[model samples]
Target: MDAVQGLETGDTFILHATFKPVPLFAVMKAKGFTYESEQLDKKHWKVTFVKRGLGQ
Candidate 1:
């Protein structure tokens, strides 16, 4: 969350977690970010959050 604080439009923040952060997706979306998630292994996941520009 701190990583996203200074994001400009179109900027991206990547997060690594032990499990899929499903709830966070909605929170970020509400803040104008879109996300993509990938499972790295049995216990690791990577989520990338991108801030959308206006009219996107």
Candidate 2:
């Protein structure tokens, strides 16, 4: 979570959490980030979200 605080201007990060999906998106949104997610390898879901704090 601490890494979330130091997000660069236009950096993107991949985050993993428990076996839930909706809540993860909710949390990322609440933290001022836009995100997209998909299931990875059919085993688990991988979420790819972007932090739009700044730009290049």
Candidate 3:
């Protein structure tokens, strides 16, 4: 969460995890971010979060 606090509008952060982080989607959305999730393989998933502009 600390990492997210540093994001500026239009900044993107990519997260890699062992499992699909479904819960985090809602959290990011509430913080004005849009995300895309991709499963790389059986054991890895990648989620990209982009901070949106005001009113976006």
Best by TM-score: 3
lDDT of 3 by residue, 1-56 (tens): 99999899999999999999999999999999999999999989999999999999
Worst 10 residues of 3 by lDDT: 1-10
The regions of model 1 sitting more than 4 angstroms off are none
Cα error of candidate 2 at position 27, Å = 1.6
- Model 2 agreement with the true structure over 1-56: per-residue lDDT tens digits: 78778886467888665444786677877777888777665557677778876431
Candidate 2 ranges with C-alpha deviation above 4 Å: 17-20, 54-56
| Better structure of 2 and 3 per TM-score | 3
Of models 1 and 2, which has the larger TM-score?
1
Give the C-alpha miss distance for residue 3 in model 1, angstroms.
Answer: 2.0
lDDT scores of the candidates, listed in order? 0.93, 0.72, 0.97
Superposed by TM-score, candidate 1 places the C-alpha of residue 12 at a distance from the truth, in angstroms, of: 0.8
**In candidate 3, which residue ranges exceed 4 Å CA deviation?**
none
Error of 2 at 53 (Å): 3.4
Task: Output the TM-score of candidate 1.
Answer: 0.93
Pairs of residues at least 3 apart in sequence or in different chains that clash in candidate 2: none
lDDT score for residue 14 of model 3: 99
Top lDDT model:
3
Is 2 or 3 the stronger prediction by lDDT?
A: 3
Rank by lDDT (best first):
3, 1, 2
